[model samples]
Every structure is written in C-alpha cells, then in structure tokens.
Target: MKVIKLDAIDSTNDFLKALASQDELDNFTVVTAENQTKGKGQMGSKWQSESGKNLIMSALVKDFLYNNEQVFNLSIVVSLAVIETLKSFDIPNLCIKWPNDIMSYNKKIGGILIENTLKSDGRIVSVVGLGLNVNQTNFTELPHASSLAVITGNTFDKDILPALIIEKIQEKIGLWETNSTDFWKQYFNTLFKKGIPMPFKNGAGQNFMGIIQGVSSIGKIQILLEDDSVSEFDIKEVQMLY
Candidate 1:
C-alpha cells in the first residue's frame, strides 16, 4: 500500500516498472503523477490530461497466481474498480467499452493500459496504469474526451481521487480468491452496449453492425454480427465506431 506522489513524471507505469526492477515492492504499491509528459494509451496512443487536473497513476501487483491464460481477469478487476469508484460519486451512465475504456454518457472519461511480466514459474507481475479525467473541462482537439467536472458540472478534488481508486481496486482484488464467478459476472453485465447493435470496423477496414456478446477470458471480444454468427477479435483487430 505504499503510495508515491510525483509532481511530474514521464509515465507512472514506467516509474513503477523501474521500481520493480530495482527492488521488491509490496503488492498494490502505487505511483501517481500530477503531470505526465508522455502518458500512454492502448495501442501506443498518447493519453492527454491537463497537468494537476486528473488522475494519472499506476499500481504494481507482485507474485500473483495469474498466468498468461487468465490475463483478462486483471482487466475485469481493474475496470470494475474504476466503474465502482465512479458510481460512488453518483456519476451517470458509467459503462466499460470493451477491452478497457470507461465511458460516461457515450464519451470516454478514462482508460487503462495493463502490462504484465511473466516469471519462469507461471506467476505474473502486473503493472496497471490508468488515466481518469477528473477536473479538466476542456478537451479542445480531442472531441471524444470528457471529464468528471464536465460530466457532473462540479469540480472534484483531484488529490484524493487516486487513493480512492486504489482502495476500490484493492477491494475488488480481495474478492478474487473467494468470489470469482460472481465477480466476473458483474463485470460482464456492465459491458457498454452489450446485446445492442452498434457500428464496428474490422482490421481490414470493413464496416459492419454487431452486438457485444461478452468478452472472452483471454481478453478477446465476442461479437454477434448482423447475420447471427459470433466471432472473437483481439484488441486492435476490431474498433467500435460510435
């Protein structure tokens, strides 16, 4: 539960990974940055956040029983944690867009980037990085981005948010050993646009309509297409077009 706060950093995920390389860190050790110069998103995209106005953090989980086969479980846990935290704020329309983006009112307010290092023995060390738009109100060039302040019309104290999110994450992780079946069920129930027709584009740049059937344990998305056939695609293999 060691928490390190930084005024500025290149990326919290990179910082925590460097710390893990240097010495052993306690499970749930967190690094938070007020300003990230090169924050990352899924597929190597840049994550933009106004300095001192959002939640930019990464947490380290060490020596887990999780193997490569169950990697998607981490995504479920972390995504549900963020969604639960936002629900506590009474935020409206909180839904997880497949793979790992948090959306509110059909716009993205947060995202996750998880990196895992596998040990020789089958255990995994995960570095879960997250960015939540907290108090920022202006997105400028990024039209699809929104923030807590923008969504709620009230400013939030950004300083306390990272800790709260970590606490929620810990609570979810604590339940993994005892109630995994029910836990993952709830995660699936929150999938954005589940069972509803939506526009999507495949890797070949072909557009089609489909419904989100639940995500696979390995993190691939299962889509029920217009013709009633089901197919699973990995991240970047499919894109949701809103």
Candidate 2:
C-alpha cells in the first residue's frame, strides 16, 4: 500500500513501470500525479484532464494472473473495482463500456489502460493506469466526456477516490482464483449496452448492427449479429457506435 504522490508527471503508468524496474515494489503500490503531460488511453488516444481536478494514478499488481491467458480477468477485476467505487458515490447510471471505459449516463467518465510485463522468471506484473474525471467539468471540445462534479453537481475529493478504488480492487483481486464464474458474471452485469442491439463500426469504417452478448475469455467482445450468428471481435476490430 505504499503511495507516492507527485505534483506532475508525464504519465503515472510510465513512472510506476520505471520504478518497478529499479526496485522491488509491493503489491498495490500506487503512484498518483496532479497532472500528466502525456497521459494515454486505449489505442494511443490522449487522456486529457485539468490539473488537480481529476484522479490520475497507476497501481502495481504482481502475482495476480496465473498465466498470460488470464490477463483479461485482471481487466475485469479492475474495471469492476472502479465501477463499484463510483457506485458508492451514488453516481447515477454507472456502467463499464466494453474493455474498460467507465461511463455514467452514457457519457465517458474514466478509462483504464493495463500494461503487463513478463519477467525473466516467467512472472507477470501489471501496471494498471486509471484516469477518472472527478471535479473537472469543462469538456466543451470533448462532447462525450463528463466529470463526476458535472454529473452530480457536487465536487469530490480526488484524494479520497483513489484510496477507495484501490481498496475495492484489493478486495476483489482474489475472486479470480476463487470463483471465476461469479467474477465474470459480475463484470457482464455491469457491462454497458449488454444484450441491446447497437450500431458498430469496423476497422474499415463499415457500420453494422449487433448486440453485445458477452466477452471472450481472451477479452474479445462477442457480438450477436443481425443474421443470428455470434461473432467475436478484437478491441481494434470493432468500435461501438452509440
């Protein structure tokens, strides 16, 4: 539970990854920054946040996944952890967009990017980076983005939110080992737009209609197509056009 607070950094994930390479980091070791000069999102998207107004942090997780194939399970655990934390604050309509986008009222509020490294000894360690919109409200240029303050009309203490989220993560990390069936069930339940027909765009920018049935064990989204055939798609292959 060692927490390092920084005034600003290029990226908390990069900082934590560098720190782990030089020294031994305990499980759940955390690095948080007030501002990230080069914050990143899924697929190289930029994560923009006003200084001191959001929660930008990374946590080190070791000895979690038994093998590389179980990597998506870690994503499920972390995504559910953030969703549960926000639910505690009574954030209305909180749901996780497939593969780790935190949403509220169909608006984007946060996201997760996980980087896993396999050690020479075959151990996998992950740096889980999270960016949550907390108090920042100005998203005029980014129409789909909104903060907790904007949604609830009340500012939140960024300091407290990360602690709660980490605590929630710690509580659920063991579920992967104990009860994976129930673990996946919880994640699917919180999945945004599940079981609903929606429009999706492919990598080639072709639009099609499908329903999100669930995710594969390897993390691909399983979509029920218009022809009643279920198809699996990698994250890069499909984008929800809601």
Candidates in order have lDDT scores of: 0.89, 0.93
Q: What is the alpha-carbon lDDT of model 2 when measured against the actual structure?
A: 0.93
Off by more than 4 A, model 2 = none
Candidate 1 lDDT by residue in tens digits, 139-234 = 989998999999999998877777787888788778888888887788888888898899999999999999998888788999998888999999
Number of the top lDDT candidate: 2
Which segments of model 1 are wrong by more than 4 Å?
none
In terms of lDDT, the poorest run of 10 residues in model 1 is 61-70
Relative to the true structure, candidate 2 has a C-alpha RMSD (angstroms) of: 0.9
Clashing pairs in 1: none
